[model samples]
Target chain A: MGQPLPAPDATDPRRAPDWVRLLEARATAHGARLAYRFLSSRGEVVDTLSFEALAARARAIASVLTAGGAAPGAPVLVVLPSGLDFIAAFFGCLYAGLIAVPVPPPRPHRPDHRMRKVAEDSGARVALTEARLVEQVQAVLPPGADVWTVDALPDAPEAAPRTPGPGAVAFLQYTSGSTSDPKGVAVTHGQLLANQAMLAEAFATGDPTSDGLTSKFRVVGWLPLHHDMGLIGNVLHPLYQGGECTLMAPETFLMRPLRWLEAIDRYRATTSGAPNFAYELCVERIPEAKRAGLDLSSWKVAFNGAEPVRAATLARFAAAFEPHGLPPRAMTPCYGLAEATLLVCAAEAVEVDPAGRVCCGRPPAGATVVVVDPETRRPRPDGEEGELWVHGPAVASGYHRAPDASAHTFGARLSDPDDARVFLRTGDLGYLDRGRVFVTGRLKDLMILGGQNYYPQDVEALTTQAHPGLTSGGAAAFAVDDPAGERAVVVAELHRRNTEDAAAARDAVISAVLEGLGLSLSEVVLIRQGTLPRTTSGKVRRSACREALLRGDLARLDGMTS
Target chain B: MTTPDGTPPEAHRRSSRASSAELRAIVKSRAQVEKFLRLGLAEALGISPDAVDPTRTFTTFGLDSIKAFALTGDLAEWLDRDLPATLFWDHPNIEALTGYVADVLGLAE
Candidate 1:
């Protein structure tokens, strides 16, 4: 039958070398499986798409776009939230052989930095957005480009999604960038498939019949669909494993930390993950009432990743959730990014102490890490804190159209003789204790004050804990360069409502940060609750906060007598 | 319901809608309508319970682009719709947003 489709080779697997064909095959195999779920604008469950149903819709969308004289590999800007429709449209772009460029969904309250960054970087001609918000995205579209909503597409008959050969461009993921300039990582289909395969093996769930782990796992995550973690880790990984998924907006999780655990309990989700901030947020904010009902026993692989994995934060989260039946071993802190198709290294479910600290663990299946000296760019010995580099099938190809950015980030890195592979410069400075990697801070985020290097997170921890009025886990510390250039700035969000007398709280935080880190802060802005800029996934956007401080957008301390 | 922390003592009894509208009007009075429509509406709308239907909302009233963001700063001006930054997630639909605006302005049926 058509040359017996040749025994699945290492180069060309049976799962269509292309993402479009591969997704279709999965949908055909498991049509009724739930693909996505989200909180509607009404704060109620509105949309849920089964794999089979989603595939049929994607096929129709691909047909409509193809009929519009669109060529393969052309960029399609998507500005939708995490929903079944967003998933369908994303896959539809792939099936139609169009490069899906996922931009930050319109938050409608935040800065346009993310949206502008995506549009400017991709140079996308067509933007697919929600029917109600087409004008919002259109206002920012690059000159001469057409923007259309999902409903604008014709209801055409289904056509087989084009299966681009291996090594072809598939999508562009935009990471942190300023409003004027945005950085996008180009991911090829081969890169995506390779990364997923590594994950499948690492998670021990590829073909449970063969991989050992049960295949009945469900992935539940609250990270934004636009982010690499949510798109790849939570969305694609489950689909590849032939599993189900449940998702919600990041705001929902942040507003009510307990909802995260509830989702896992309701779905009996086996795998779920978030950055270190999420765990800390839950421990610090979740009300006592919500904690009484949560049952985290069903969770087998709870991931804590994206940002640096804090030893203290994980310890506290486990202790807090233990009462709710969350097993100590369920916490799995992994490391990954958009450059690595969302997974580079992930800790396994291992035994943890009462303190809630588990090792960052070993490299996932085929993944490897090399800690290198930042200045020398040479590999360093274990237990030494340096720039963490990752190498594996998971590393992305490079930046789109910006070879300089590509070489600066992925191309020019020290190679290891043992691995003989190009490593992704994680830009994260961390040390390995035994085999577990302990991330300290980002290279750009590390503050150099008084000869000793200090991570802002460390300072923030001390500040929040020391200040009685200031809420723990609600403070952000970043370096701001002013006339008195390159000084630390601590911004604390107070628990008590705004007071004419916050000098005591501010002074306490400042004293703690300065005394703990042995450096003085140039300014300390005590803001109301929920003032810091954050990604959709709830990770503090340090860069944005710095930008706000430099531009004088933050409230001034001029009037504070303290 | 939780309220904005910075409200003055005199504003205690007033519904947040009036202050929100006062803030929106102030933001609208100074910024360009196109800019407000592009960025301000999105930012105000993101976490806000206020939602705006582009088709039926601000465009229906003959408010010019300049009136869109006189109170909010430049970030809000870049948005395509003229809703305040708080309207993104909160009042995302047209009727709810208009009701919010009307309540804030103290406009009655």
Candidate 2:
């Protein structure tokens, strides 16, 4: 198809490409075309930016950073709300040849230690944010890192643009890691563009020669700009295709699920996506009256990812919105992680395996997926479950500043004699069946709820700190799938077992988790001391504890409710 | 019925705080606000209204951030007022939230 799309090779001078160059060319080619539209909570267009305006603003912000003595390859933190300023600041960092780090703004009245930890880990000396969040971001950022309000910067049309090499770091994605140790995945320009190309090939959004197809590639979404799915999949993918993207705040969509569908209808968006929970929310919360007005026929790709894809959720969503012009083939279940730069595999339609796991489709062109035995580092045959290992140019080189962790995760060599490629250990367990990927479960002890990653150790530490009677290393936190969604359940061993003390301990654990982690526990089980299962080395076996809890094998403390 | 934590049930707490006639006379708006929050919280938790104790904190019923925000959004829609995003966090219990909401609506007794 039209020269078979060249592989993304940053070293090739003939095709040396980066997002900055791509955007600059697009600005010159069609400066007046719509780039992004920011929508208000009520679905009103509050802000609009064309390619020309976006390029100008990015240059203005870049000049400010460059004039302020920002060196090339330095990491700059972008802590702004979901709006035009966030997008401009991100491009501004790239324009200045600095690595952009996008993170969520701190919540009001809450001490954002996570943001502070990220700043400390990345060693970001300059932070860009909106005017209203200048003070908030300044309070959380490490001392000496200047916080500049992007809106206040003056436009500098003659600013000298800095062009970074393809191998240079483009951005630092800090989606993984715990609060105490935040790891920033260093994604190079080559890897970023390569992943974007893979996505285009998989979604068939390439080929700019087709004017009709290019115009029909409009994307509408409300995912947060900081997350990988939103940044890479929703934001960058549209730019790669030279298509328009309309965005609204995640809170706006969550407040009223109907607004998302209405936006799709209003914009006639060809692509949109959210996690499985969002689809479930639409089915549960949106009344019938709201559905009558939605016309989702324009939505060609409704991707569900960032968490486990439930067949039931997809079926329910399809059945509910079928009458409103939604085609059953529009649902796409995808699998990806920050380390992979965005997407790894995605299916065009919902195809559930006999085990009830939804298919995530085949690996895109130039990418390879192999299941491997986590213990032996040996590759598993097809239809066998094991840790998934990905090999391709789309996989990131490694985590920034952590060579040992990077080598362990990104330097795996397959045992097969014929295949000597380095594979990324995806910590996710799945199997390949008939050229399709069906994810079974996670091998790591991480819990994903509401599209947010929560480490078991973080939750356990918070739970133990909530009450003195609870043992420090005696708590096991894990996720259990329910019809509502994936929910966390904490089983803790308490020293004191009196009725009042047990009740107080349970309440304290719940409150601490909600306040500290912003998560709700489906159940707080107070077990007797020495009842929690542990390994020979005394580490808590979380999966065993989960199974025991599911089987009602854990001995409940006296006076504790089920 | 007294909860396991020895706290009185929702009905008992309501009656002890103010008689129905006195509450109606003092402020009819307070009851309306409380009923709205109670019903919204019940629906969010997938529990019956009778099982919801207003005196108990929102966290006691395991209200996560997403559910809290969703409930607050529904309350904002029902009241037709632009409530703060931290409405639930600032006033964690139903009684405190009702009081704050009533005060914000200028229905203080």
Candidate 3:
């Protein structure tokens, strides 16, 4: 920790002028102060970048990106591991006025075609990535894909940062890998700044300009840099505060959850969190002996988001770490989506709802949240179930290149013309109670399993074609929550009077699903053909299939209990 | 508890929930430890036991932190001894994990 940088003005959104100028100001003010501390897997500090050093590196990369004929509004792909290199490339995109499209490098030795889909969907010609991944990514790229390692880019004259207008597109936050139709949420410069400020306020991180740590603003977490929570919360917000962040690879945290807490103690980090499963991981993984040396007293706001927050998880985590000094209220069960640029609402307190509704706090400054009746298109009174709609500065205007989809999702208006403002339909089923948003379940059939979104149709498509016994369109994949975690339960109907051996077919189906979509189906129920419920349009009724499985109504052909 | 060859005597390895006779009857050699892990992980991950790659990392099977913790508890129970949650991370693959678990229990080298 060198001489701390003078705090930037984080109060005003009008002055945000996008994130570029803020970085420039912070770089000058906090020239020697640490901006990012990247930790190695062996509990070692591999790289630490100062604010000034980070800016210089970013500017150098920006110069290269601009010199290579990338347009101001074009999307530049950020395909690097979670490290300082990715941070520089991202800031370089913002510096060069390019929308940085961050995505996980194709799963090693596997064709995770999502990379190509995102690249083509974003129309990104050039990709800023590590040298090691250049060959791997190049093999998947269409002809003439400009793949340049950020380190290889020669240090050139620092390009004048291209600052875009407030409404100008900053980055395309790809919501999911919907393969055929990927969603790139068009987050503008204004929304980015607004969301950062809003998140800071919600997380109770006192000042916008002061990096959260000095005033207890430090965020220590191992969330993937490509994710919304990682990008907006961990990376960008710290930059906005002119503060430093201690970041580790997601694998480091996954491989050892204790390292995440160790960093919190090591850095005296005040803010750090992950999905609910992470808290559970720490609770279940960290034995009593390993917990002896840990001191989580420095952890002030351990806000859990990105997945369903279980009250039991919060209680277990608090009870387990109370001796080590993790406060009860520190485990805040908040909620947000990429559509809202990250923090839509954060609860005021840790009040567990008996109905299993995790309180996703009141809307942040200038943000309005309402639960609208799905069919009526009318606002429902608080304490009633309905589709949640959010209207705010942080809410992105629309999905990139998908006008109809954008109009339906973003331009949501109640039947009452008096409330004319457009709201982004969250598609989450929840009710606002006493000004706090309580998310109950998803309105749509989107299943979030193991922290990743898996639409039933995509899974159904994979499972249905798994075996000859399975009808081409007679399979349904749904999520079933058990003690272990949310798992995919596949209920497929086999062809009637088929001579195929049920055991072999079942194994083939399971293997096919794993190969086709890389998803491990927890239970595969082989029912008699035509046993699966279907809608009038001949589409498989996933909910009915799930209900039938749960209620034990489906007839099993193999006489094996699934 | 050491046998003549230095490995822990198979009969001495104890499990709390179950009687030693049944548990002892199951695992006699080093290969059994690998088989035990393969079956445990395969069932936990919902794949056929044969499909569970001994060389592939646990995360390759889409094992998240939640499932890892659950699997750890199961592993601890089967071993009849308490184990740290980092066992998965330390061992990574089934083949390596089985060797580490066996070494910890002093079952075989």
TM, every model = 0.67, 0.91, 0.86
Per-residue accuracy of model 3 over B4-82 as CA lDDT, tens digit each? 2234323322333476556544556667777667766776667788898799877656564446655665555455555
Candidate 1 lDDT, tens digit per residue, A1-562? Answer: 0011122334332256777777776676666877666653223677788878878877887887787667888999988876777788888888788899887676554345457667877878887787877877887786766665675665666677788766888889875432334567888988888787766655554443432222376888878787787888888888766677888866556444566788888878888887766776677556465487788887877777665565676678788888888877777777677777777766665434344334566675567787889788788898677988888766888888888878878864575446456777878777776666666556877664321245777767877787666666677788764321245777777664545547667666655654343345656787666777778887777778778766766654443323
Candidate order (TM-score): 2, 3, 1
Instruction: Give a tens-digit lDDT track for model 1, residues B57-79.
Output: 43222221222322222222222
Measured against the native two-chain assembly using Cα atoms, what DockQ does each of the candidate structures obtain, in the order listed? 0.04, 0.30, 0.10
Error of 3 at A85 (Å): 0.5
Kindly give the stretch of ten consecutive residues in candidate 1 chain A with the minimal lDDT sum: A1-10
The most accurate candidate by DockQ is 2
The DockQ assigned to candidate 3 is: 0.10
Model 2, residue A269: displacement in angstroms? 0.5
lDDT score for candidate 1 against the true structure: 0.64
- Which regions of candidate 1 fall more than 4 Å away from where they truly are? A1-16, A39-44, A109-111, A207-215, A349-358, A413-420, A446-562, B1-109
Report the lDDT tens digits of candidate 2 across residue range A95-145: 999999998888776788878888878888898988888877777667766
List candidate 2 segments past 4 Å from native. A1-16, A154-158, A207-209, A497-499, A558-562, B1-28, B47-57, B107-109
Q: What is the TM-score of chain A alone in each candidate?
A: 0.75, 0.95, 0.94
lDDT of 3 at A278: 84
